[model samples]
Target: MLNLLGLDAVAESVYRGILDRPQDVDDLCDRLKLTEKEIRDALDRLSEMALVRPSTEDPGQLHAVSPHVGMEILLARQQAELASQKQRLEASRAAAAQLILEYDDRRADAGSAEAGVRYLEGIDSIRDHLAVLREQVVRELLTFAPGGPQTQANMSASRPLNQQLLERGVQMRTVYLDSIRSCTDTMKYVHWLTEHGCQVRTVPSLPNRMIIYDRKAAIIAAHTENTAAGAMQLTSQGAVTTLHALFESVWQSAEPVVRQARPTPGALNRQQAEALRLLAQGLTDEAIANRLGVSPRTARRIASGLMDVLDADSRFQAGVHAVQRGYLPSTPL
Candidate 1:
């Protein structure tokens, strides 16, 4: 009960023990079954609080003061300290809000600050700022995550944030490599996202990794050799329009991951048809792997398998035969 007034367990126990009877340090150690250091530390804190005192007959013996007097004084001091901290915290909060408002006002007035482009360096910074952007999204969030499915840890990090965004009633549409549906970790995330009102689609290849928040601000990753180099944030009308148009084109041809992508004839399997289309586009094996969400070796094996199925000796021959088989249209699109 004394803990509510700032007394810790050891201090409270020692005070109660002294109230039972005045005792020397050695007696306290024996009765409380505590180390001498612990008993002495408790006595020192209680003495400072005026909750304990030395016996007049033997200065080494400890005695408890009246709780009605001593504990009430301790409680009053603690309450005053808490009130002071609360006032300081409120002042800091007000100062921060005012500072941010003035900074934004000044930024809006600066001509150079109107460039509408922000270059962010480092993957961690990019992710950190993305969280900031997510909070500002109101109407919709459109994202294209190219290359492959995200790792489990990364997905876990954003899982709650994504769910919270949906709960805010923000419309979300995401695009990924068609192969994400086969990965256990990413597929699980995708399932959860869709269940919570996120619309998801997939394609054999996406032009780049991009996110457009309400079509107002667009962020594009600049990655090389599967490593994130940095990112670009574009807010100009021209840039946003161009990126949105590109997304629309891809979104049109992309397959819906679930609740969509029904079969169409002319007739290789969906995986083989996607592989053939990518090959016909002259994409390298590694690029194909990124598009297919598979390893480079697996991508090469897929290409080889397609070649055999078409009875072709080379990729060009495979493309030609695949077209004749109606797996791909004459125009690559």
Candidate 2:
């Protein structure tokens, strides 16, 4: 291989001999025991590598280039190539670093003992991590959600994961605020969950949202003045266990949802029910519609209907009437 690259042992020996003194072809041939043709061939190869040059003193003789000079030229070419490669590598590394930083910002609270935190950057990443935890939740799954009903978007994201957990015989328990009982989408979800052998309960008020999986992992939203866009995952077993303990304490104080009393007929339509539920939770009509998978116009119409039924002039009054008339379940108030 070295010979294929314009170099060989014979060429090196010929170059070394020439370095001692300019040698005519006959002198080189006699000293190396090489035929004149062989000495000429070796010198030709060395000349091609720029390691030997024809002697100015004699047209038939050759002189070896100083090894230092030859090596300097080769090293400069190598250095230039390496510099180019380094520039490309640095550009690639910079782009990768920016991506990691952006992802870390989104998942800053999912602390890890590893060198880098395992970030759940997008909704897909969150789903994937949830799937892994669901698989590990052999014993139980617990949740406390105080916000409006799980949006259709959230339900769509979680359904497949919940099904997988159910298939693995994992036990599930969910506690929701009483407002969920009035949400058509939530009712649908709750019905599905019950059918899958999961237990569910309702409390009059919920302080925050939480999910604990197998006493191993917990997800909590940061306590910010602006609660949205501030969430974190906790993977410490001890901390997760404490959250689970809190969930159980709340669970014991909640009321079991009576499946028989679930509205079947003469209940509000899905959109209207979702609107009323969100309104009761103090969500604006726009946010309610966004969560309910409906248009804002439809949400406004629902709110209007609720007001008419409650014989109230404003949303606040309507909410008060609904609560008083048992439109919402009264549980552990």
Candidate 3:
């Protein structure tokens, strides 16, 4: 139909009316119940589209072109346009890639005094950015996960990524809070990493949570006080060097987390000890529950009992008291 070919309804009707033969505007107007001017306008549009053509015998009359011919021409033109657009996009992609390379070269020449810094505003953004950096890991990766053990979900997400990095021959060294070793989830992930040739160690505390990629770039929590707010990528020589140095200093003093989960002779049971230990590592009760394979309620009960024994008013206080009493080992056992 002419309408499907981009003609108005009036144009479509006028074209259809004279498909078998040519008709002038006045005849089309009478057949379509339209004004002569409307018929002329319709015919003009149809003519422009090649849907209708002026008859060779009578220039005043119009007839429809065979769809096989008209539509084939339209479709061929559309295909050409699409191919042209694709080529333009391909050219733009190449230009963008070149720009990125040039920018990187400029940054390298500038040295560590300047930085390629960016802030990832939300958790999803932070993770996505980190994922990109992880993929680009060439030789080495260093991560410092402060506070405590990772949640089951976090551990699960990291499993395949860590596995892939190792598969690519990327050397990885992760530093965790010593308390993470007490959690089942962290233990599992650490064992998996060690098995796959990743070096993992733990410190009692870290100043910030960060990941350094090949000493060329580093990602650190943006908020010094509230690291959960967002993350920042540091690509300046000075900043990256500072972070790398921090990681190295800590790496030297931190103890290697033993993959072997051993029973501790202390005031708490293994599950309760692990839960309390994670609490000291800066994990919430929810995280504690995830690691202990217990319900949140159960984890809280264990924490509450420990708090009562320590006579502590807050979770942090409970952690310190537990450590002081040897309920949670602060050093590698």
Per-model root-mean-square deviation over C-alphas: 26.3, 31.0, 28.1
Model 3 lDDT tens row, 116-230: 7666667888888888998888999998787577788888888999899999999999987655755877788887899999999865445556899999998777654456677
**Candidate 1 has what TM-score?**
0.61
Candidate 2 off by > 4 Å = 1-124, 223-230, 259-333
The TM-score obtained by model 3 is 0.46
Cα error, residue 260 of model 3, in Å, equals 9.5
lDDT tens digits by residue: candidate 2, 1-333: 123123567776787788889888888888878888888888776665577887878867777788787664333322211112222333433443343343335444434544233444444555566666766778888887666567898788778878888888998898876557668888888879888888988754444556787777676544412235444566655556556666766676555664312223334433354456557668887776555444578678768877886789988788777667656534311
After TM-score superposition, what is the CA distance of residue 228 in candidate 2 from its true location, in Å? 6.3
Q: Of 1 and 2, which scores higher on lDDT?
A: 1
lDDT of 1 at 125: 80
C-alpha RMSD in Å of predicted model 3 compared with the true structure = 28.1
Off by over 4 Å in 1: 1-113, 224-227, 264-266, 326-333
Higher TM-score: candidate 1 or 2?
A: 1
Q: What is candidate 2's CA lDDT for residue 2? A: 27
Put the candidates in TM-score order, highest first: 1, 3, 2
Worst 10 residues of 2 by lDDT: 77-86
Clashes of each: 0, 0, 2
Query: Highest lDDT: which candidate?
Result: 1
lDDT tens digits, residues 40-73, model 1? 8998888877889998877878779877887666
TM-score of each: 0.61, 0.43, 0.46
